[model samples]
Target: DAGVTQSPTHLIKTRGQQVTLRCSPKSGHDTVSWYQQALGQGPQFIFQYYEEEERQRGNFPDRFSGHQFPNYSSELNVNALLLGDSALYLCASSQMLAGGDEQYFGPGTRLTVT
Candidate 1:
């Protein structure tokens, strides 16, 4: 299996700009999770998608949004981008097991806002 994959490997955006990143989950995975990782910081949970619905979200502003497709793929959309929004956007895929969710992360898309 391909584990997880992200697109546009790298990205650069200006302040107040809008950007979107894509992700494909591993085989047989139904849930997708998005995270933001700033330099020297741990990944911060952004949101999660299940059955194409936004199951959970983080403290990010409204500018940060996302969508999950029927094929189990996902996208992270950020509007009115800010300098503070520059970070490594990570995508994780996993299934909701009884024990817990063991997420597998993608390489991530680096978004830089000038």
Candidate 2:
């Protein structure tokens, strides 16, 4: 089965433009999480989606939002992008249990805001 898939392997935007990235979780998976990784930094959890609802979120601004579909696919939307927002946006997929670990991550969508 497909592990996870992300669109536009790379993306570029200006300081104030918006961008939307897509992700498809692995087969049989019900949870999708978004992460941001800057250069020389570890992935920071952005938010998590399960059962078509946002279950958990990280310490990101309101500009970062996401949605999950019934089919387990997801989308990450960033509004009023800033240069600081430029990072490797990663999409991770995992099962929803009482407490689970080890999420499968996609290559990532590299976003650069000039």
Candidate 3:
């Protein structure tokens, strides 16, 4: 019954550096999605992974990338980070069904770029 979990609850980095975030999906979940949320804004989709493949992506730049493991866990990677990249990185998990799919989000990793 464990829920989605993220690592390094808080991270601070200098501009132009790279960072990687980790996520473990909830039990019985098969799909994983990544989102970015600014301080006062709602979560914006980064990308989604299912069957170890990227199923969908958002309007993010090429610097954003991700991977889904066979166990349904996932990792989000950002390269050439910029100051504007500071935000909360959220990981959500859900079982993709024909209908009635409910997604549960993780606590989120706070990223600060200087």
Candidate 4:
């Protein structure tokens, strides 16, 4: 089965610009969650989507937002990105509802905001 995949394995951007990252969940999975991983830090949950609606979110700012589609794919959009936004953006998938089970992650889309 095809697992979760993210685009632009790596990315570079300016501090004030915006960026959008995409993800496709693993087959048979229905939920998608987005995470941000800074250097030497663990993945921090940004938000989660289920039934095409945002089900849960973490302590991120309003600049961090996401969307889920009917096909179970997802996207992460950051507005007025800051240098601190530079990190590995990971997308994880799960078969159950929010926090009900373990999630499988993608390789990640590395974003470098200068």
Candidate 5:
């Protein structure tokens, strides 16, 4: 009965590096969404997953990728990290059938790319 959770609360990487952040959805949630929040800015949608398929994506480039597993857990992968990639990566869970109106958020993973 654990709620949404994310791992490696903080991470540091250099430019051109790659990193993967993981998330587990709350019980009963079938959809997972990823967002990136820059300092003093609102979270920007990265993508969403339902039934292990990427349902939607934002304006980010292909360097940003992700996957959803059968158990509803998800991962966000970013490649060729740039300094601009530094941000707090947030993960949220919701029931796709509920119109995803209510989301349970996980403590974000802070990523810093030098």
Candidate 6:
């Protein structure tokens, strides 16, 4: 019955550190996707998970990783963070329907790398 949810609404970290963000998918949804939105730019797809497996990935480096849980929740991890990595991280959930997949987005986690 819940929509997508993300934790630690905001975060601050120093360069070269690591951070992990968490998300819970909406009820009846089976897919989770992550996106990064930099200032003055549109969101960029980070990766997607379906059936607890990574289904798609974007142009980010290996420093970006994610995991999808059996319960359809997810986590996004960034390692060796850089100042440029600072951005708003969003989590979206979707489910396949007769029409198409309908996606719902969560309030993003704002990450600031110092």
Per-residue lDDT over 9-34 for candidate 1, one digit per residue giving the tens place of the 0 to 100 score: 99999998999999999998889999
- TM value for model 1: 0.96
Residue 100, candidate 1: Cα error in Å is 4.9
Best by lDDT: 5
Residue 35 shift from truth in candidate 4, angstroms? 0.5
Whole-model Cα lDDT per candidate? 0.92, 0.92, 0.94, 0.94, 0.97, 0.92
TM-score of each: 0.96, 0.96, 0.96, 0.96, 0.98, 0.95
Clash count list over all predictions = 0, 0, 0, 0, 0, 0
- Weakest ten-residue segment in model 4 by summed lDDT: 95-104
Clashing pairs in 1: none
lDDT by residue (68-101, candidate 4, tens digit) is 9999999999999899999999999998745449
Per-residue error at 104 for model 2, in Å? 0.6
**After TM-score superposition, what is the CA distance of residue 12 in candidate 3 from its true location, in Å?**
0.4
Alpha carbon deviation, residue 91, candidate 6 (Å): 0.4
Instruction: Give model 3's TM-score versus the native structure.
Output: 0.96
Residue 98 error, candidate 4, Å: 10
Q: Which stretches of candidate 1 lie over 4 Å from their true place?
A: 97-100
Where model 3 places Cα greater than 4 Å from the true spot, the runs are 98-100
Residue-wise C-alpha lDDT for candidate 6, range 1-114, written one tens digit per residue: 777899989999999999999999888888899999999999999999988899899999999999988898999999999999999999989884522266799999999999
Off by over 4 Å in 6: 97-100
- Top-TM-score structure, candidate number: 5
